[model samples]
Target: MTDDLIGKQIGGYAILGLIGRGGMAAVYRAHQVSMNRSVAVKVLPRQFIDDLTYMQRFNREVQIAAQLEHRSIVPVHDYGESDGQPYIVMRYMAGGSVDDMLNAGPLRLDQIVQICAQIAPALDYAHGKSVLHRDLKPSNILLDDIGDAYLTDFGIARILGEAPGSTITTDGAVGTPSYMSPEQAQGHPLDHRTDIYALGVSLFEMATARRPFEGDTPYGVAVMHVTTPPPSPRLYNESIPVSVEQVILKALNKRREDRYDSAAALAAALRTAVEAPQASPPPDPQPSAPPPIEIQPLAERPIPAPVYPAPSAPSLRQVPPASVPKRKRRPFRLNLWVGAMIGGVLGCALLTVVVGIGLLIVGTSTSEVGPGETPTATADVTPSAHARALVNETAAAVESATPRTPTRRATAITNTPVERSGPSGTVIFFAQRPITVDGAPVEAYNLYSL
Candidate 1:
């Protein structure tokens, strides 16, 4: 059916090319002949025209999406049936979907915040209108060329205040399993908070590059959403701020009551977190130096008493003349004793210096040789470039393996053009007028209605 509709004209709109296919409809790039504008057309397959459930869902999506008039929502231009196939014409978006960006890598923190901020207000507006986007995931988020986000795909949305059991339900569970909130997974009645939970999941993936929960099958994943606690975003990407993680965790609370009261509240938290200063980790402690050693001055030595050499004088037999008065040898002996004491002190000082030098050498050699090895002089070897690179790489690997406290940087919000006004009696166009899905002028449609 998609192949046949590529060049075929349906309901006065010529199908230019196929955009993509979904479970229930195929979106195509089409030229609205009557309006002379290029638009995206989501066409239901011919096989599903006869199916009551699919037809109801298709009509419901058209009704819900057409009434939504906001900057962050894809505006529906027309809806009609041709050749037993149903299709809805919407403003074409050229920048593709958030899933496309996620495929490349995890988005920057600032980008995630900006995207969430855009989506939050959109969800709040829908909630105000009694609309619940049951299936809110990255794939349903469309982006513009300048990176503005728009929420699309309300196929499974439930309209509040409508008759009970009026909308389609599959086995009581109707949302994508991976992004389903706890209540949605349990097949319980839902409210706006379910959409908030799904948005939290999308934000988690945007920040962490992976969903918080995973399982082998759809049912298993759904079960995890109900039973498991979401891992912290910092666990995947250490740079994610604590405040940002807190906001996400609050949005993903298992109990709806614990989650954000409204999308506006969630958006407010995100904005505050993005603006908050990041707390830095404490510095590592340094080793202390050894204390100084004090040396005491040597005490003065007492003079030795003159020694009488009676026995030595007899042996020498050299008696001095009386006139000479036998100059008391005490002075000479005293001088000699002083010289001997000085020499002994110098010798002790030299021995101490030699011991200290030897000890220092032994300590250094032991450290270089490491434990349980005899000390030997090692030849200095210059490493080749390849070996040096390998060593550096190995050291880096080890350093990375040794987990350190994660540090986060405050993400400054860049001055990107964003639409912030809610649904109001007056509409104002900000920087860069809204362009069509194909980057063409949007004519014949009031993209925003007061």
Candidate 2:
């Protein structure tokens, strides 16, 4: 049916929306009016309704699909023809299909195997019923919300015991090209092995996110199925074990005899590979010298006669000898010279600290010096900055004065006068004399009191 039947109600089932549409039929999400339960109703497309070949095939699919009663196979509740359109109603799967999962990227090995395991049994059941599903790809495998895998679309399946040339349509290729088995690609008679091969392609795509034989055209891919060997799935994903790859490759063999006998056989192999204990390969042999073995001369070695100890001898408890006491070592000798040097350094540091403290006290103490008693001025007075400049200038003048007497030395004691010019600031000084101390040598020193 076209999109018109989407909102239309049929036989107590209200068509809610269209989930998907294909070449032969369109699947719609509908609500069962009687039970108010939601289900997916697959009706033949409007374009294929008038085609007798397609109608017969669609009706046969419903009958065959209804026969499959496995958990992984979608359950067919009812089938009927309304307004000359044949439809098959099936249980709705909320989780969509494997094709949706593959749209993003390849799934992990465990996930692929798990999905495959569920679908494999369904295929095995249908194959036992002599129904060969021509289209067994990711899109045809539905996953429910509970992680259950369901096989769908028996529309193009070939019911066994029927004439080989009596298929619905024989002019063109029947199933999806990317997932077709070698026999299907060659347009030869197909068996359950064909389904196994298709399932292998599906598993390969799940593991690699791409088909085994991909081409720009369908014809080119069909040619690959007949000619080329598919690359190992592990090449795309290194996480896949070699055993898994072997199983996938065995199923994907170009020849029917090379593939597994049935989907059950393939599923068993996969389960074994998944559950079987992994074994490490044998190590390579190494060439080396043999070990040296000791040998004794029989003539030189004496054989000892067996001797038994007396049974009456009783063992006595013995005390262990006392442990030897550890001796004390003498203390290290201290060097007197080093001690003296250290003491001298410490004494010097103390003296310097004491002198600094005394100088600080002398500078700060006002009562230590008699303030009323002014010190008498003496000839040996402290040198001021001005006086120092005068002394330098006088030295230069004296040197110039005695230019002819270079060898003679002159010593003079006099007050050097200094006259300086500044920015309107008068230079004044309070003069003071330096008095001789008892132990200090007489010398000119600065007196801050001035």
**Each model's C-alpha lDDT?**
0.75, 0.73
RMSD (Å) of each candidate, 1 decimal: 50.8, 24.0
Report the lDDT tens digits of candidate 1 across residue range 241-343: 8778888888898999988898878777877787863542112345766888765555755667999876543455677666745655432122445545644
Model 2 misplacement above 4 A: 169-173, 275-450
| Candidate 1 lDDT | 0.75
lDDT, candidate 2, 1-450, per-residue tens: 337986898766899998887777788999998878889999887778888888888887877787788888898998887887778889999989899999899987678778877888888888888888899989899988887889998888877788656767443578888998878888887778989899999888888898888999998999899899889888888877777788889889887887888777777777677667264211234576689986779888778999998788656977889999989875443355654564465446534643453454335443444757643333543545644554355434433432232222333333333333211122323222222222222222111211
Superposed Cα deviation of residue 281, candidate 2 (Å): 10
The residue pairs in collision within model 2 are: 378-433
Clashing pairs in 1: 92-437, 93-437
Residue 301, candidate 2: C-alpha displacement in angstroms: 22
TM-score of each: 0.60, 0.60
How far off is residue 176 in model 1, in Å? 0.5
